[model samples]
Target: MTRSPATPLPPPGERRRLREAGALTRDQLAERVGVRPATVRAWESGRSTPRGRSGEAYARLLAGLAGAEGGTGEDGARASAPEHSEHSGHSGHPGHHDRRDRQKAGAMAMAMAMVTVRPDRRGGGTAGPEPSAFVQTPPPSALPSDAPDAAADLTPAQAFDALYSFCAPALVRQAYLLTGRRDLARQSVERAFQLAWDRWPEVARDPDPAGWVRAAAYEWALSPWHRFLRRHRQPEPPPPDEDDRALLDVLLHLPPPYRRTLVLYDGVGLGLPETAAETEATTRAAAGRLLHARETVAARLPDLSDPRELHQRLAELASTGRLRSAAPPAVRGGSERRARFWTRAAIAFTVALIGATTLTLRTAPTRYEPPVPPGETVQGVPPPVAPGPLSEEERELRARLRAEFPGGPERLTPQAR
Candidate 1:
């Protein structure tokens, strides 16, 4: 027995045409099929192709419309003989299938490109190149308007875990690009998130909590401590591809600020002002660094001069090195960790201060007091002076006298005075 050939899912344009022909609004169709409007939009825009139940449902709808219009039915059965024969040549055309496949691939590429073109933080149109396919770029969706107040209800540990889960991978990827070492990059992200965990109350309440984490991650990745540590470790071999190795080598050789600017601007898709804020530089400085970085890369790789090509190449570089999400360092309660860190520091400081004070008191100079004989009423007295210059014979005589009689000097010392 032979299985029948599966029905082909309609192309995005065909699906749109069917919807228009049936006079069904996008939302209506989406609701009928139990999917979000966005999913329907994605189908129409060729950003996604439906599958399984959704695919069957779409095929059924199109077939029903085609049957009513006196054309092909669900099983590709033609209602009119002449029309079927006329379109028969088009149906078996292999070239036509290839063209459709290319269109679908192009659509998919365009969709993937839009994922990086985020809406402006200030609620503006999508920033970056004009997307080949249209996507509704909504405002940066926060944790809802009520999320800020609700976030406070969560314990610091819970808040931190949430932030870490949401933000760590992207942070790690950004860090990885900034520092050419994966271990250092991961350490940097973990350090930054740990810092965020410590300050969750402030971060959770901020307008853009993700921004805070990104800034911290970028700074930690580019810090001197990492650089110093990196010097002692054996350098890893270059990346696999020549282009990747050359680009990364050039990036590593750039000034730290420039490298960060490039990562933020190109790698992270941040605007100049935002990149500047993250890098702790003025907008003009960030722009200059970005321009310089691009020029440097272009000078080395001439193919990257085109803005579209440069953006695409940089995006590819960033994506190729993306780190798989790893289990984060165990999160202690943010409040507890912070309290413990500071508490330990304070205790150490206090112990050091007390020890210092005690040591100082013990070693300090004191007044010199002459010993008094027991039961003797001693008066303060001046010491007696000997003659200005004694002859060697006299010194020998005085020494001999002192040796013979212990009290001789006291008895004879006043005679010279």
Candidate 2:
């Protein structure tokens, strides 16, 4: 009889996890690994095993799934009961539980520190209440339906989804323009959303959530981490697909300010006023930036008929994952392992500039100096006034006054008097 073709086997990792969880049946494992049931039986019997990339990928997926289901012994698995209690203290001593709680609290504090939002540049125009006050306010158990205001009804999750859907794409596009790298764009956008999630209620209530997200993205893009990456690391360009190449060329060639302005106006669809508000510029200045941006793009890509087409193309590139192939500029290794060195450098630079400017202003001479008279003395004594060269009428009046009163001549005092 002719021999049947050999069957593929399940990934080692997956098979191991499944066995540990008591969930593995030969037939089921075989189906999962794309092999015949007999092949799975042979492998479980130690007669054969799967190998290579496909096996590895299958193993990783199975292990991840098993971990999610609380299985033990998988690489990604939750700890066994004893290990869990030892570390997490779900069933251990009270001190262990307290320590775990404190550890969790510290981790949360550190995460919050990573993406701290600076004070709004516009002062208190739209940032809502201070953080301390907001923290004290209790969150409602459930969001009220039929609430008249959109802001009042929005939950953190809903707000995040809204901003993600509305703002993330625009931010990603802007980041692409700035860095000419899709991964950086996506990361920048995601980081911005992560930040938005932290301040969801406040951001949700703001008049322009999109603008707020864009500003957050810009802040992240210009952050010290980003700057360091740009300076010390070089990002590899995306694969040379036609759409990818075209988009990259268009963005990379744009002057930095024009690229920023265009992305804010065209990609994000912010009006001049809103863009100006987010960028902390005047409306007229924003308009000028947009006008210049359009002109620049039009000049470079004259073959393109519509400005809207560029945005559409970017959207397409993003959706197809063409843009995500580029790697982020690496800043993972070096002196500041946990904190990015560039961020520290930027903070130092800003502080130094402020100090220098303050010192200069303090020491500089006043612009408006008082005028000094030619011969007048302003020291200790009062200045002498010279006698007037009188007109004929004034002399005649003086003579008449002297004749009218004998004391008039004495009244007309000497020049030095």
Candidate 3:
């Protein structure tokens, strides 16, 4: 209990996403948020959290970005990148405002994540081909050509819709990959959104609102408890394509942590650190999981020995289903109802507990009173003495009495009168 509850914020990964979604250079964002660029870097890298006034400013900034990005949900997923790749240009070495995030993961991750070794048939490692293309993380759009220009100006409902429209579609696909069940995936996204709706202010102001919901959805989708549910005990139908089925099977074969890391990094295109943050893992741990996952997949389906192939296959597999999201109104309403019900239940429980305590207090003895001994049969009273051999004198007296009064002693009953 000594450990305080963790402050709710977008994990380090989300800080980077918010930065990218806004299409602002870290420096520009820092300038506006009133912090140094290095601090911003630190925030994004999971090195530190924003603290005090500066943190508030940063939160406000992120809130603005989240709001803005949520507005452009429809046209958002067209993640654009420069066509020709120079290692240096892709290095994302600072100095550009309007450029969409060069890489959601940053240059170092791009370098470290590019090529993973392939395991040969003998289980030894060899160099393998890299992923074909780096799929950028999708930014939930907050602006559109036809809609209002500023996201901050929008109403709460509108903002929630924007956030949902931006995240729900892709989130469903991602959830399907995690759960390997379309229904579960849909439920997970809906459930996550409902929770988000309940905590709308926190989520709306978060640096990466999408990432917040995403983490929740992933957690729910991958929960071990789901296996106990009758509906989820049996597996759902597989993807239609033969390749997709095999890929999904391979994915499902891995442990949940490894699978989540792979999907977040390879499938979702999160950078190494970002993936680690989102998965609540250390960078090294995330790397190990990712590496192991890739090895396992490659070993099982040699065609995907390259991480790139796995990434592409993951996207394809996730995209194959009809994992649609429920409407914003329904989700929001459900959230409100659930919140109210739980609140009432908690209040009732508290009232009942207090009443029981009050009754016990009232009836309980005020002073310490020793327990009374249990009643036992009285002792020391002699048992009825049967006739015993009479003493000489008593026997003589009895004889005399018997001689004097030949009749035995008479007993009389009371007359009715």
Instruction: List, residue by residue over 93-181, the lDDT tens digit for candidate 2.
Output: 43333443443333333222222232333454333211220011112222222122333334445435433543344456557666766
lDDT of 3 by residue, 315-387 (tens): 5576567667899888989889999999999999999999999999999999999999999999799899788
* Whole-model lDDT, model 1: 0.63
**Each model's TM-score, in the order given?**
0.52, 0.38, 0.58
The clash numbers for all candidates, in the given order, read 0, 0, 8
- Scanning candidate 3 in windows of ten residues, the lowest lDDT window is 140-149
Q: What is candidate 1's lDDT per residue for 194-287, written digit by digit as tens?
A: 7776676787677677778777877777788654564527686566556667778888888889988887676666777778877888999888
Task: Name the Cα RMSD for model 2.
Answer: 20.0
lDDT of 3 at 366: 100
List runs of model 3 lying over 4 Å from the truth. 1-149, 374-417
Candidate 2: residue 254 Cα off by (Å): 2.5
Ranking by TM-score: 3, 1, 2
- For each candidate, the alpha-carbon lDDT, in order, equals 0.63, 0.52, 0.70
